[model samples]
Target: MVWKLPLHESGHPENELTAESDGAVIRRTVLPGGVRVVSEQLPGQRSASIGAWVNVGSRDEQSGHFGSTHFLEHLLFKGTKRRSAMDIAEAFDAVGGEANAVTGKENTCYYARVLDTDLPMAVDVISDMITSATIDPAELETERGVILEELAMNDDDPGDVVHEQFSAAVLKGHDLGRPIGGTPDTINAVPREAVWEHYQEHYQPETLVFTAAGNIDHDVLCADISQALKVGGWDLTPGVAPRARRDTTPIVGLGQESVEMTIHRSVEQANVIIGSTGITATDDRRFQLSVLTAILGGGMSSRMFQEIRERRGLAYSTYCFGSSHVGTGTFGLYAGCTPARIDEVTELMVGELEKMADSGITPAELERTIGQLSGSLVLGLEDSGSRMNRLGRAELVTGELYSVDESLKRIREVTAQEVQVLAQELASRPRSIVRVGPFGS
Candidate 1:
């Protein structure tokens, strides 16, 4: 996965993807294991972000092994042989930087942000942390207590619970159905040996991607990644997983799904979420969905805010969001409204979606949607964390990288017909509804 100078863009970059760094050179490096590295270096920005991305996530876990990835995330934060967790936290904080990681449907990311001058320091710690950190017995026990509290907190909050539960329902029989934070029953059941076993199999650097953005020299970064690969190799086997089947999936209306999330501490406001699975991470149509989401619920001028709140005062919050992954994704709508107005509000929201289904958006709406999405993409890329994410995720999902221009182009070229198609497909999914709050009748 090494590239020579003047490396040409691989796939056609999206036309509207104007978010690239002018000074940046996109490159790839193949390390010892099959790890692939991709990046864009922006010399003008003062900061750099480096991250280790593993394609394995909670969705890849075996039954009874739920939340193992997230649990593993906690264990990583505990002291390693070289540094105590406190020491690690302090080291980053002392430098005016932040270090963090998260587990998702198809990937787990460990990232660090720092001054461009400290780029080597950034890579050194992340490389060592991901490749050689020891999972000591004492630290494991202490971390379990921390993770249990985290799980309890999730259980006690309906807003969170409904999303987790809804995920379970949508990805049923699939590893993705399980919560990223394991239940006490499962977590307590998993022994120390199993955690180690999972790590041994999943944490292969060959399947990993390391990325850096801002003030990075492509050659120097490639050299750093090569060194990390030499440190993390193991007896590797080729990885492959068949896509799960969803042949009989229904176009379930909101009423058909049982979604009751009640919190005892009653308040005037309640959050209602409607969502379901729609696309894969690699689907080209996702760009359209991004644009459509902005047009439908992105800001005050967006349809949901204009129609649901401004005109009727039906809710305080309203938005549409899309979550995409290597093989699957979820699209959702969320709003906080008066419990007394839930029925009216739900109907109004449904009408908006239905209107899109029947009458595709006008040309002006489509253009505005693309503009907002393109601007948002550019703004997000200014951060090292976000840049590293974009690079790593592109490698993991498509086995290729996209330029900022490519992304913008995809968004720009999305026709009203495509948005209509996406809308129709989204509306057709088994629409699960979750409502949490008071309704005194």
Candidate 2:
């Protein structure tokens, strides 16, 4: 935000992964209970965001309790030892701030964004919910109806329905392949203790991180976070696998629901999911894969949108993204196009990847892609929420905080030769695909 914002925070290993423009002071501290803290100072902004990201998500669900993580997320909003769900909402609403939480494949995060004056209060309310969450049976039953409604909502959307099926198909057996939200039946069947025990096991200090970004005094943050971390009286258990990780058959997890909504009355838009075996959060070559994603589908001027939309007008939208967890990652491409163009679209998406694998990207494409990515990185920090996510996710995956300059350096170092080697090896490698359309599949 100022001239000092340009200097990168040095000495943190994870910074190389997330920061883009080094404009803040990044600090890391380890507290009792194995909890990690990442605090970043963003000068000249009035808003701040604090996020508590736990290192477990839907994939961590045990059999018969398939959607435990997501279910648990809902129950947290019901109430906690220190506050009712409504009371929690009112506190933030009184100040016009926002509070929310989400469950993902490898982690669960609860965050609040508020004016800098409210950071301390925001921290307490959020910390209370995560460490002191109490799930009442009556509340879980009520939440069941809410979850079922969510499932119904997903069923009504063709795109969501197919992606859910894709997750089911891809991980066939791995937690990574499962939906973050469990099935209605599984959600109903889970007992209170099962969900409670999960928190005990997964929400350990070592596996959790408290992150804050924007408009806060650094010394105050250190003290406030230290106090927030101290409020939770629960003892964290060590050495337990957060949840049993299961392996499933590798397959193209595809599903179809045709004719239910009057097949011919609707224009045909097939949803496609192409994914492959994972990479690690700490992998050095991740930037290469990121560059490949941009060149292929990042913008209207990029490869997919340019060739598919600008040049030939073969489809409406196409894009590719690569994601990595602590132990696994995926490079996936998604597209929506008319049924008549499905085969051609799929072919083009796969073909470009193959071409890039065989013949590396041109020098111009590499330069543009690298530059675009660097710019995007710097822009993301403008939002306190984005900055918090950057820090929270960084602590979860690599256990370090980075300065923005450190992150941009890594992107700048991504080379055409590096991307080609990585892309070629990955594209040639097997990928599980899922498609939902009118043509028998």
Candidate 3:
């Protein structure tokens, strides 16, 4: 009695078991065991990309288990019931493909890219890792040190530390503010049992979405997944819907006045991030914000680039960015400059943002940014890996999918007035400022 979910981007009744297309056929099926398989078929492609997206991340961790999510990510690849770590690695190497995984704020994905002929092996290896990992205590202890070393390496990078500090300051008192790797202290405290418990609870078939793109046949991929799941003894009965945690708490207090902090480091250059709260991932205003970001600091011709680097020669790198999560986001400018010019760089960066907000972008800027956004969007998806990511993220995170044409039309429809209104709102939000450099220079 499995049924397909709605296919039309707009809301529609769910009755059919599949949706068909000529260029890209998107198919979704709820396996008898509750696992949802969603994939796209591109007729002439040679390479295939597949991902196992789990709906859990660092933000979902309870107290005393800070780095458990990321810790699990490492252990999953260590070994499975039937394959040793080396065997798993060599399986992909034999197929001339690459396998890796990443832990995000709200989800974790294990993916592989391989020729279409080798997709079955890719599917089998990834599925085994997800469903049958041993999570051995000895392996956990070894990887714990590896993860700690990684964190220390991140601490040594000023740019990385400042961005992390900025997030902590802006998202103070919120789970989203914490680093994805969790602090070293928390990582050390997480026992092997806790890691196993987190995995069992969150890695259910009902909470996972399997996605593939490139020269793939959705039906074939689905069959392979069904067989692989059976190997791990996952029940193929109908399962429950994924659990949703809606966090609508606004970032309070920090938005009233600019909150500033500085970390003194004996670095050659000062890394600074001047940013404030912005829109969420699902907000309609995201399109407008995209245009504003590009115009302000997205490229070499952007205002931030021309003003800070080209004209004033203040920095070799200066750009603005916007990041959106489920309930909230941030928009900020980052610049690395000589320690002597820290004050001047901050002033100029802030001045440009104020000017843009106060007066809005010019006609030329709007048109150029729109074109740039349009090109970048289309160009970025010119591969199976990109398409696979788009499919996976849309299904697992956004819960909605957009055709390329639909996306381009939305970007083209953004108007100057829309950008201005959104820019003003962004500028009016409280700002969070972070600086990392040597003090008393």
Candidate 4:
């Protein structure tokens, strides 16, 4: 069983709680100014991973500000009031640690992995970056060119471009459909003021989650974070409720019709994705859907790999994936094959989908997929970085926390019938196809 620490809301300067189960101790401390710090101490681990999770992403941007979130992600690393980009780099390098950040559809995370003894420095540096970024106009202009190069790079990859088209086709007219990196035009047009305004509005103490995992003391780390933020003039007031969760329900008005889009590129290989709308992140069927996806195309032993690569040698790569957001999701089967074989590949992929929907997976497939899913889940959490990510995402995104054992048990409890039901439900949805290849092939 997973035990969650009881939270204290008594307006204390540093209200703390701890929960222990399965040999893992999870701790939480509500600091002044409504900052929430959560940590998990892993025994005998020499490294610590920490992340400052901000509850904003591309989906939160308005129409004209398409790439503001991602652009800001880059700008934050450019310089802070206390440290230049070079200083920040040297700080991490001195500790033999790595620092990075990522912007997703719904959140942005700035994280670092460092020796356990350097946990304090990691917290200080990351907190400083978040709370004190200069967002200099000169820096913004430089980063703008960098981001345009990034967009150009994406344009050069047919596989990446096809997935973008697939998203636009299926989730048309919604912010979720737009690329996380704004288009070149939008990126160029967005004024520096707009991004700064976004940063100010979203980067609040209450909207951030600070999480660390490894051999560390939660109380000391919390104090370090508080001190760091205080250096940037953050008001550490206690007793305020954290910001309410953002509503992530995308505006969906496109009719549920099968949409097919083709992007004519000069690439030698055709990249294709056959996909459909899927359940939300909060849906109960997600576990079963995961199992279903695994059996269909998760590994060399998966059905798609065996049928497409092993038997026919039609493609070197083929797989199925499911992506869930706060209120919407997608399931897709992707293949990269010679343009000459695009039609055959699509036919076979779609046929497999129809078969799974109608007949369901066999008992052996179900057991094997469950085992694969279980093993993958266990193996993924073996490091402090993974554990830190799990903690931050759970606190910021899902709002539900579970221990490793608890998560594995849930995956193990998925029944064959449940997977079959989910498979049929997902397969029955109208599929949208996007292909990128030479025009006449």
Candidate 5:
């Protein structure tokens, strides 16, 4: 018997069986011009979720194109050459389906959920938006205001503001540090020509990945994508392969050390985020870090939760969070507490990190964290939308798909020693501290 590795995104054959386990069958098909289609079929599922992932994101924005990637995501659904915005909305509503788009640091996804029979329609509508958006000047102006309002809404939340500030401070000079939606200045300055140029340059067949799960036929889905894309004026030239996975080499001079800043907001509670540079998305130590994060502040029983909330009643919410990108990541702890308790909470948070760095999780803590992560990993994929998201991310970011059991195995294999080492490394890194509250100027 021979052991074979899973198929990767860059150079797999035209069609392949990517993974099969228990009752789910996952497959992949590469179309002309590097368009990739991946799908998973759950035998008994009646609902299907589909996602069209474009390889462009905020980090890909050029000098004048800041926020254009996310702005383009909004523009796509505004209207396409073949359908009006209202028509697009009604198409999904009439079928009782849900559709939306998400623009992240590294990619954008337009996704929908509907009955299995409506999968083709979902694909057609989303593909049309992706390929043939008119980017009408009037509609662009309208969406600009909407996005500005959206940004304003986010600014109103101290927690969101704090986290955004933390990223900007930590990643300081990096493109990844910029907000996904762009700042008000950039959004207002980004002319229509810049956005259209961005659209024409990045939204090519080689830069798109299509994925779906739940009652899907891989070949049929690929065909549907092909037909819809061709109708929308895409050139599906043969022999092209999908773009390679994101390079994981750490971007040079991208992180700042020991930076701290405070913003005054007229809020009763202070929101604080203390974080530092962490692991990349492809780093094998992500599993260990996952365990480490969970034990530190993942849930109610987590150390941060128990100590900060249950023991002292200092804060109503406390948690540790992390974000992993191609070659860099951010790890931090967040707590919202009364303004008077800000210093005390910050001290405790730093103290807890030092403790973990010095000593390590106990055997019991390790066991509980493994179980917690395993359960969440499996439970999060219980729906078709989650499954579709998993496929799209695997194909877009990591380039390889791991089965649920394989993912669980990796999580369970994380050792206490590994987690401690990761913690120590994280603690040693210079930290970035951000606070948002009504502390006197």
Candidate 6:
């Protein structure tokens, strides 16, 4: 069934049954410092997945803290008050559990998966890292070199560069356009103190969300996290609320009708991306956009794949993609092909999108796309990690959570007309094109 966004009203209840259906149960508990403990119980599972989601990312970086969000992501795992870096690493290695973190434009997550018995240890370790990262000056210096190398590695890939350029062209003058891994210049300029200040400012209890899935008991998990955070020295005083939802005003582009950018790179294959700003995270037409995306370039049978690869053999890979954020999102298609055929591939990609907008998908295509999206959603939730991600992202990002079945229903109900309407809107928006390859040798 459909679930409403969690209540963020001041003095929200300490415990609430967010959603329950079939054999699965979902519950949420708010702690003294506004730390949220949300969990889903899946019977007959021996493993559990947990994540500590912080509601800040590169987009939230202040003047001196560019790239510090991702920087902290690495530093947290370096050491904590109680556990050394090696101790943290060995803790998971000894148990055969997996742990990692991701820094996104909007949030950062430190997550892990382990046997049900080891959930407590996992919780304690991640909580320690989140609340007690030492961020040693020496360690920060070392990671600086490491992050610089990471940025270099990313720049080495033309496919990656093209997408980055496309975002810069589309979301020009916006924080979202900046690379998540800050540029080398920015990284070198940011002082260790800047990172420390960033950590202290954003890593508050109210900005933290703890979510777990599989063979989990809500109350036990909440108590464990409370003790862990307390040991890590977070203020647990009562009367605080979780961070408010991000403002939902749509961010529009401020430029001419279209923009084209080309970066000269010595690469065998040219990479290209053509797209435009699309929708917001809370847009109602997201389901329709999904259907349209799949129909145009999602898979082997998709129009772009069939024409660009199967029929013409102009490219080795071609696909469509979209990313949504609080205010604006991106919609684009990419292809890596022989430099000689770049023009043909670009035309084909644009033509496919235009065709879809001019003439909506047939009934057969609509049915197939709906099934494709529905099956993908169901299959992705077969494990605890995926379910944990669903819960965490729903609570953190859109603030709305839907059961697997409910999500499937939404996809299935998208009408072809709706998909066409979205396609027409996206097609009409000003486009940005980014090309990366050797042009004049």
Give the higher-TM-score candidate: 2 or 5.
Answer: 5
**Candidate 6 regions with alpha-carbon error over 4 angstroms:** 7-11, 254-256
Displacement of the residue 42 alpha carbon in candidate 2, Å: 1.1
For each candidate, give its TM-score against the true structure: 0.85, 0.85, 0.94, 0.95, 0.97, 0.97
How would you order the candidates by lDDT, starting with the best?
5, 6, 4, 3, 2, 1
Error of model 2, residue 356, in angstroms: 0.9
TM-score of 5: 0.97
lDDT of 6 at 137: 95
Query: For model 3, how does the per-residue alpha-carbon lDDT over 5-63 read when each residue is reduced to its tens digit?
Result: 53231112241145544367777765654566778888788999999989898889998
Q: For residues 318-389, could you state the per-residue lDDT of candidate 6 as single tens digits?
A: 999888888989899899999888988999999999998999899999999888998888788888899998
Q: Which segments of model 2 are wrong by more than 4 Å?
A: 1-21, 226-232, 235-267
Global lDDT of each model?
0.69, 0.71, 0.83, 0.85, 0.88, 0.88
Q: Which stretches in model 5 have alpha-carbon errors above 4 Å? A: 1-15
Q: Candidate 4: worst 10 consecutive residues by lDDT?
A: 1-10
Lowest lDDT sum, 10 consecutive residues, model 3, at 7-16
Steric overlap count per candidate? 11, 13, 4, 2, 0, 0
Q: Kindly provide the TM-score of model 2 when superposed on the true structure, using C-alpha atoms.
A: 0.85
Q: Candidate 4: give the clashing pairs.
A: 33-236, 33-237
Candidate 2 Cα lDDT to native: 0.71
Which tens-of-lDDT digit does each residue in 1-441 have in candidate 4?
A: 544433344255334657774576888877777778889998888999999999898889986677899998999889998899899999999989999999998899999999999988989889998899999999999999999999999999998998888888887777778899989999999998899989999898877789888898887998899999999778777776566665556536542888999889998899999988887776777788888888888899988989999999999999998888887888899999999999899989888877888888898998888889888888888888888888877776666678777788899899887887888888888989999999653
Q: For candidate 1, write residues 187-231 as lDDT tens digits.
A: 878777778777777876555667777778767876776665455
